[model samples]
Target: MSTPTRKPLDRHALWSLLSEKSDFWTEVNVVGVTGSTNADLAEAARHGAEEGRVLIAEEQSSGRGRLDRRWTSPARAGLTMSFLLRPTAPRETWGTLSLLTAVALEETLKAVCGLSAKLKWPNDVLLDGRKVCGILAQAEGGAVVMGAGLNVSLTEDELPVPEATSLLLAGATALDREVIAAEFLAHVGAVYQSWNERGPASVIERWQRNSATLGRHVAVSFPNGRSLSGRAVGIDADGRLQVAPDGAGAVETVAAGDVVHLRPRD
Candidate 1:
């Protein structure tokens, strides 16, 4: 862990911040460490916990990403949290939350930190084509728990992977986790309300604007040990990646998979 000590988020201050933004968030709580914020919040939601409960963990020990991929972050080095949401919209559209959060992070980072962060299809936030954040959404008892891990101030040697980066590595001027989280949740509140009222069309448009996947050749590995590669053409209605294979062929919508962007064909 870095030598810099980070104070755990003050529940009073965090709740105050959330309240000023909107009533959508019911509570904001913090934990020093946890296996996964998503898991903890999901359990709470299952027992009839109200929506808009936000849980932040200063450190995650057994963090797992999509497809059970391991995700780890040093103490106080990243934003690791889960927000509970109960949406009246069709469950089918829930997948868009990941994409929506990615856009929210981009908006917050660019506005507050002036970092040129971008989004890869699905739910990865990248700075200079390297991932700086990942999002995962899980359902429990008619509610959703959306967790996001945002890297803030990791040294080059502390990075979990070569393909990953942190704000510090990306030349971010500000490393204040609370500021970033507040700004990001504001956008999340707005987007969630908009999506529930209008639909996902506008959110999709905003996500596309920050997309680094569109127009790139990608290989998507499926759970069935299958992989598909093609040029990412668009995002489907269900928020899946639309890929047009090499040469003229039908476009395939990938529902879930590990996506690797391949270099442009020579």
Candidate 2:
């Protein structure tokens, strides 16, 4: 297999770009390697780090996804970033932050790289029905930390799972990490502000507009082996997933679960 050509991002260049383009970012830190950007930011938040602090890692040795699944990628072959925020909104609204980032990333890819990406409700970004990105958000007290891992240049063999894809494999026109990161942060900042002012309605509207999960049959699984099969209808006001249980029932609001889109029966 050929080696990846993308090198570690220069913090100076990234900070300069953020300073000129982003409205909310206060600090940007890039590490060559880390266990998880989310972990780093969570620790910083605990230590009183203010909002708009970002941590990006070239590689994550102990990266994790939703439900504590492992997330790994080759050095400099993916975009791994976490942002710390202190929001004025109620804690319940924090669930929408991951949705906000997914929408922001979709817009960034479309406007920056010309790649068509869609959100697979709750947290995954899909390209041609295969995951290209994953988002995880953790909230504590007034601070909320979000981590996003995007597959950029990973080859087929390097993909951690069969249902995963990278921007390169998805035929993105550009592969500039700086440009991608800058636009994503800028858009996320805008979305965060809008979400704070207008609440999840506007954010949910955009997320639904670009979603591939709604209006489909899905199975929401729990670690305890319990599952619910339903037709995903929408996301509620509190940012919980709304699904109409399989047969004929009321819309059930799911606080947390692993969602899987089921194939249409023949």
Candidate 3:
């Protein structure tokens, strides 16, 4: 057997297909390499970049995840991109941006790649309990920039961590970045438009249906140095995770944290 060749995304094709799929996206920008798509989009948002502008990079030198942790992948090994949004929905609903994005990713992987993806609360998409995608949302002025990195063609030896997996590793034969990216954004536009028009209840419902974290024992470490171990009960209206702590503590609502699913004791 030989290594499969990874193809570069077709900028024109993605722009055309995404436009036909949804009128929500304004433009698509594909770069060979970038420091960070999220950083690029956030700066654009500050300078009045209109909503629906997308920035995608074939490789990221300074990619980042939540808590500013470094994220990196070989050139063309994955789909790394950022999308800009300035929704007219109530400001309170904005927190659902990452959740909605994760939901869209789950839908896209299933629809386009025939893979059943599950959402891990906050901003992760898991396959076989391994992370295949990570999402990060940054607020810039009145706009929001959401970035997602989906491992596509990385092999076992190329994985960043033992806990990470990719589409190829998950048995996906079709690894077209353009199709995956387009399908994902199309889903994003649909969910986002629905959230703005029909409110976030529907989006939240979809997220809950695809979630793997809810109802599971989890340990969350907050930025403030506090931690909670509990069963994830629900997602609050503000997009925080509501957890029923072990023992006898009030259900804790997590705004931001690193979550690790804990196995139940035998």
The best candidate by lDDT is: 3
Error of 1 at 63 (Å): 1.1
**TM-score, every prediction:** 0.95, 0.96, 0.97
Off by over 4 Å in 2: 1-4
Clash pairs, candidate 3, are none
Q: How close is candidate 2 to the true structure, as a TM-score?
A: 0.96
1-266 per-residue lDDT for model 2 (tens digits): 46459877988887888778777999899999999999989988988999999999999999999998999999999899999989888777888888899999999999988988989978999999999999999885579999999999998999999999999888899888988898899999998988988888888888899889999999999778889998999888776788999787888888888999998881
Give the per-residue lDDT of model 1 (tens digit) for 45-90. 9899988889999998889998888999988888999999998888
Residue 222, model 1: Cα distance from true site in angstroms = 1.1
Least accurate 10 contiguous residues by lDDT in model 3: 1-10
* Candidate with the larger TM-score of 2 and 3: 3
Error of 2 at 221 (Å): 0.8
lDDT of each: 0.87, 0.90, 0.91
Best by TM-score: 3
